[model samples]
Target: MGSSLLPEEFEQAALGLKSGETRRFEISLPADHPDAQLAGKAIQYILTLKKVEQPRYPDIDADFAVSLGIDGGDLERMRAEIKENLERETQRCIRLLLQRQVMDCLLECAALDAPRTLVEQDQRRLAEIARQNMEKQGARNHNAPISAEMFKERAERRIKLGLICAELIQQHDLQAQPEQVRAAVETLSKSYQAPQEIVRWYYADTQRLAEVEAEVAERNIIDFVLSKAKVEQQPMSFEALAKASQSLFTICDKRPEAKEGPPER
Candidate 1:
C-alpha cells in the first residue's frame, strides 16, 4: 500500500512484514498538516498487512462475449459498437476544442473593458459553481470558504466574451430560431438511451427549453466567428485529442449509447 505521508523510519520498519503481520510506530505530524486534528501532534499508528489478493482477468473468447451480453454473443458486433462509441466521443472532444479555439480567438481580437458589476456577479456565480462541483465530488469540508477573488479573472473574461457575443448577435440577428433550438436538443438527446423521451423531457419545461436555446445561440456565435476568423486545421489522433481534453472536459455520469436519430417530440 502507498500513503501520502509516512516517516522513513516507520516505513523501513514495516517493509519486511508478511501477510497477517503487524507493527506499531509513532511520528510527529507537521505543524501545517492538512488534517487539523493530526497537525502538530505525536500520533501512534498501527500497520497491519491483510491477506493480499491478485487480480485475475478472464480471456477474451466466446465465453467472454457471452458474459458481455452481446446480441447473439457476437464479438464482431461488440467491437463495432465500441468503435462507434469511440467515434462519437472523438467528435464531442473535437467540438469542445473548436469552441475553445473560437473563444480564444475572440478574446485576442476584441478589446473591451469588462463591466465591474457584471464581473462581480459572475465571480459570485463562479465561486458557487466551484463549491457545488467540490460538493458533488464528495468533498467533506462543507464550511470551507471559497473566495470569489479566485474567479475574478475568469469572471472578467466571461463578461468580456458575453459583451462581444451580445454585440455580434444583435448586429447579425444571430438569435436562435425555434427550429434550431429543437434540432440542438434532439442532437444532444441522441447520445442517451430512450432519446425521444429525453427530447420530450427537455421540451416539457420552459427553463430546460430556454437553456437549449441559449446554447444554440452561443453555437451560432461560434459559427459566425469561425466564418470570419482565419482558422488553422490541425490533424490529431483520437487518443491524443481525448488526452488533451481531459483537463477541460467534465465526463458526465452517463456514457453515450444510442446512435440512431430519436423521433421528434
Candidate 2:
C-alpha cells in the first residue's frame, strides 16, 4: 500500500503518479494492529503501480440479470430473488443482535474466574479457527506467527460465560428436553426446501441431533435471561439493524487482546 510511509501515507503519495511508477519506503505499524506478527514493526515496502482504471458497472438490462445467474434473464425475477435473500439476511442479523444482548446481560449478572486450563484450550481453539479462516481466504502466510495473547481476552470471556451457563442450566433445570429438541430441529429445517428430509437427516445422526439439542438448551438460557432482565425494545429500520449487527460482529471478530493481566477472582 505504501513505499516510504504508512498505507494511508502511501495512498496519498500515489496520487498524480503515472502508471508503472515504482517507489520504495519503510513504515512502522501500530502496536494494536490486528496482525500481531507485524504489530509495531518497521518494515520496508516496494510499491509498483501496474494499472489504473475507472470502475465499470453492468447495464441494468437482461444481460445484467443473466450475469447474476438468474435463469431466463428475467430482471424482475432477479430483483425478487435479491429481495427475498435480503429479507432472510435481515432476519438472521436481528436474531443475532437479540442473542448478543441476552449474552451481555448474562455476563453482567454473573462474574466468575475463568479456569486457566479452559482459557488455554479455548485460546488455542480460537487461534486455530482464525488460521483456518485465513487459509480459506487464500492468505499468503496462513501459518504466519500469531500471538496467543490475541485470543486470551476472548477465551477467558468464553470460559466465564460457559461456567455461568452451566450453573444456571443446572439450577433452573434448563436441560434440553426431547420435545424441545425436536421442535428446534423442525424450526431449523424450515429454511430448507425439503423440511421433512432435513429433519430426518438430523435425527439419523447422533452428533447432528446433539448439536441441535445444545442449541435448544442455549436458546432456553437466552429466553430465561430475557425473562428476568428489564428489556426495552426499540424499532429499527432494516438499514440501522444491519449496520448495528455488522458492528457487533466486527467487534467479536477482532477479539481484542487484554491490555493488562487477568484480574484476581
Candidate 3:
C-alpha cells in the first residue's frame, strides 16, 4: 500500500527512491523567479493519484427505456430519434477533428511567429468573456484572479486557429448559397409547433437571417473539407447518432433584443 506524504516529506522521499521506483514531490516558485512572467507572478498545482479506474456502461435496452420515462414501444421511437441525432453529432465532431488536424499540418508547414500585441488583444477579449461567465454563475474565487500572461497564451492559440481556418475557407472558395440557407431554416422549423411562425421570426430579423446564413456557410465548409479528406465510417446505431447530433447542432433561441452577427460556435 502507498502512504500519503506532505510536500516536504515527499521531497525527502524522492531523494531516497530507487532509480526505477516511482516518486513525487511538491515545490513552490517565488514570485520573482526567473520563469515568472504573469502579473500575479506565481502559480501552484497539486498532483496525486497515479492510477484511476474507468467506469463501464451498462447495456441499453428495455430497462433503460423505463428509466428514461417511456414504455418499450415509445422507447423504440425515442431510440430512433436519438440515433438520428447522434449521427449528425458524430459528423460534426469528425469535421472539427479533421479541421484541427489540417490546421496543425498547415502550421507545421509554415512556421511563423505572430505579433505579441495582437495575441494580447485576443487574450484580453477571452479573459473578458471568462470573467463575464464566472460572474454570471456566481462563482467565488478561493484563489488569485486569472492573469494576463495566462490568458495571452490562450489568446495566441485562438488567433492562430482562426487565421488557419480563414485561409482554408478562402483557399477552398467555399460559399453558402441562398438555397442552402433556406433549407437550414426549414430544417430548424421542424422542431417548433408552428414551423411557419418560426420561419417568419427568422426571416423578419436581418441579423437572425445572417446568423442562419453563417451556419449554412459553416456546414458547406465542413462538407467541402470532408470531401477533400479521407473519412472512415464506422457503423453506429441510428438512435445514438441522432441523439448526439441534436446535442451537437441544436441552436439556442435568440433573445428578443439580441442582435446577431455571425453564428456562434
lDDT of 1: 0.71
Give the alpha-carbon lDDT of every model: 0.71, 0.72, 0.56
Candidate 3: stretches off by over 4 Å: 1-80, 141-145, 189-197, 230-265
Candidate 2 per-residue lDDT over residues 1-265, each given as its tens digit = 4322235757865777678998877888887555544667897888788888777887989999988777789989888878877887887787668777776666776756888998898877777777777787899899986667777866776777777778889999999999999987876675555678887888888877876676677778877877887878898888777766763532113233222221121
| TM-score for each predicted model, relative to the true structure | 0.67, 0.63, 0.53
Clashing pairs in 1: none
RMSD of 2: 9.0
lDDT of 1 by residue, 70-151 (tens): 6577889778766877887897788777776777777888878988998898788766766766787798995587888766
* Model 3 Cα lDDT, one tens digit per residue, 174-243: 6667888888887767544467887888888887898877666655555675677776767766444444
- Model 1, position 21: C-alpha lDDT score: 96
What ranking emerges by TM-score with the best candidate at the front? 1, 2, 3
